[model samples]
Target: MLVALAIRDVVLIERLDLVFGPGLSVLTGETGAGKSILLDSLGLALGVRAESGLVRAGQSQASVTAAFQPPPAHPTYALLLEHGLEAEEEIVLRRVVQADGRSRAFVNDQPVGVSLLRRLGALLVEVQGQHDQVGLADPASHAGLLDAFGGFEADRAAVALAHRDWRAAERALEAARAAIAEAQRDEDWLRHAVGELGTLAPEEGEEEALAERRQGLQQGEKRAEAVAGALSELTPRDRRGGGNPAAALRNAARALERMPPPNDSIQPALILLGTAQDALAEAETLLARLVQEAAPDPRALESTEERLFALRAAARKHAVAVTSLPELLERLKERLSALDAGSGQVVALEAAARAGRAAYVAAAGRLTERRAAAGASLDAALSAELVPLKLDRARVTVALTPRPEAAWGPDGQDRVEFLVSTNPGQTPGPLARIASGGELSRLMLALKVVLARGSPVPTLVFDEVDSGIGGATAAAVGERLAAVAARVQVLVVTHSPQVAARGAQHYQVAKSVTGERAETSVTALLPAARREEIARMLAGERVTDAARAAADELLAALT
Candidate 1:
């Protein structure tokens, strides 16, 4: 509820402060008394569009602040939290408009964008009037209001849950389809590559092992070749060649034996040659053993080279290191396996999605039925309120239109609008479009009286709801306003004495001229002052004795 309002340099209102309480409060004054200026000031504080002309003369700027004390669970607090603003026991919304028409907004003294302030203001208070019916005028709020009145929380929750499930299932199906499509595009390539890799069957660390073995074999081959060359030179293939030292020594000994016996010099030469021949044979044997021990298997080296080359070629073809080939092979195999299974997976997910959508449709269908029933009840309730408010020819309807399938949402796929026809045989139209100023205000009052229990805003301000009506009709408007105020705070600007008399709290708006400057002032009326003010409203500029008696009777009836 709005707790207080402070205005400074706003049109005729200069430095005015007024405190308010919860209940039906009426502001009454004569024509040209600046009553509308108070509502304008309040609208400025609520983040309405500001005009330079609203600033007082000779003032550079005008500022208005409105304080509200909503409950902890109020949606305004939630909105503040969403905007990274903090609110304690009180939420103060302040707006300042420059003489150039520029404006700034603040909430709880924290600077904020005017849009956010406007949204918060909407959640805090709803202003219904001849031309400023905030919540009622907007068709977007109709569905929510209907849902609130219908009390379809459980059904709405079911629909929301089903919607989430359906969307999840759809997403899962899409992912599976994409995966299968990509795999199918690569199916032939994958199969051929898998076959090629399976044939190669590369192992981790096989390259390094083959390389080490090749190096050892290469060193052995070199040593064996060097040994074979040395052995061939030491023992030629032909025995007749003089290069064979052992053969030459044996022939020399045979020649020496043929010489005359007892030739000691030749005998010494033979002995020495025999010793040389023995050493030569022993060296040949040693060389043969060394060749046998160092010789490498050429077939084994060739096989190793072939295997290593095959592995490296496969690595290059696959664009991966030899060590990673094993993991890559496994991954490709898994993808191929998934390709074989993806069709069934897609079918299952499609079924799940269909089931989910079916569930949502069922829940939403139930919610629609309930809302229709509630709409009928609402139409009846508002009908009861219209006649006494002097709208006997008016007909109100709760129109529910089916939304397109593509536009379905968790709120259950129906568009709710309040339509009104002010006269018989006239097609019902939107409340704002069909009703005139006075008719619209009274219609809004009737609707509000019915929707008070479901309204989220804590305060409702009506500007001249008693316009174009008097006597019992004005009294009826006041009674309805009081009934609504019982559920939420209400403030009505009125000139009807019947409406003014119904207020639990009254304020008189009067303009005073001081030193060529006219300023608006608001004063909270005590019991005596309130009686005089209502009497003045009844008598118009003069409070006659009869008007005073009528005011007393009006006040006496309240007790």
Candidate 2:
């Protein structure tokens, strides 16, 4: 509910601070007592369009502040959370209008846009009047109002969940289709590549091993022929073996031994020949091993070189190191498999999609039924309220249009709008098109009275809703307003004493002059003062004893 409103240098109101309370609160005074000015100031503070003319004479700027107290579970709390703002018990909305016709808005002392303030204001307080008939004129609020009236939060939630499920399924289908299309685009390339890699059958480290072997052989090939040549020079090959020099010397020693018992010079020759034979045998053994090792087949070297070159080129083509060639081949093979075998997978996914969509539609259909039922109840309730408000000829209806094709929305694809017929023989049309200013206010009141049990907004204000009402009909409007206030806070600006008496708190808006400046002032009137004010509303500028007594009696009846 609105707790306080402060205005400074705003038109007739030079400086004013008005505190409000719960239940029906009525503001009453004589004609030109500045009631309209007060509501206008409130609207400006709530982010209404600003005008320089609203500024007080000789003032540079005009400012207004409105404070509201919302319930703990109010939707405004969630809205604040969504926008990264804090939510507390009290939210203060302030607006500053400059003489240049520019304005600034603030909520909780944080700078905000006027549109945002207006949106938040709507959830906190609903203002209905001749100019702003938001409550009845807007069809967007009809479905929500019905849901609130019927306590269908769970149903609404189910619709939301179904919507989420449907969207997720749709995303999955799209992703699968995208994958299939990409695979088809590369089908031919994948098949040929898969065949080539399979034939090559590359092992994890095969490229490096092949390259190393090929390099060792190439280097060994260069040296092999030279080594053979060197061996030929050391022991030249001929048809008759080239006899070892030391071995022949040893044979001469054998002959010397046969000669037996020689002199000292012969003994020295024999020793030298024996040493030469031993050296030749060792040399022969080493040369035999070296010849065997350097005799690698030239054909084997060529084969290894070819294999290594193929592996390296493939690695470069795939943008991978020789060592990563195996992994790259495996990935390409997998892509081929997907393309070849995807028909079955696609069929399965299509089936699953059908099931998911069917489930969603089923859930949405159930929710639609409940919403339709809720709309009916709201229509009946509002219709029941019309007779008492002197709108017996008016017809109230909730129009529900279902679009199965577009029905996959967060709120079940049903477009809910309010329709009305203001008089007999008139066809019902959209509320905004059919209801005139006075009719709109009364219809809004009727709908509100139906949903007044626990509305989202904590405060409700009607600016001259009794504009076309008088006498008994005015009293009935007062009774309904009072009834709504019992559940939430209501502030009504009226010239009817019947309505003023219905308020638990009565305020008087009057024009007073001080210090050469004429200004508007607001005062919270006590019982006696309230009676005098009510009497002024009842009779005229002159207050009579009978009128005051009648106001008191009306008050007595309200209690």
lDDT of 2 by residue, 385-503 (tens): 99988899998987888876755577666787878999899999987678887778888888888877535778888988787778898999999998889888999988788888898
Ten-residue segment with the worst summed lDDT in candidate 1? Answer: 236-245
Using lDDT, give the best candidate's number: 1
- Candidate 1 C-alpha lDDT tens digits along 344-405: 89899999999989998998899899999999999898888999999989999999999998
- Give the worst 10-residue stretch by lDDT in candidate 2: 236-245
**How does residue 167 of candidate 1 score in lDDT?**
84
Clashing pairs in 2: none
- Off by more than 4 A, model 2: 188-342, 513-517
lDDT score, candidate 1: 0.89
Cα lDDT of candidate 2 equals: 0.82
lDDT of each: 0.89, 0.82
CA lDDT of 59 in candidate 1?
Answer: 93
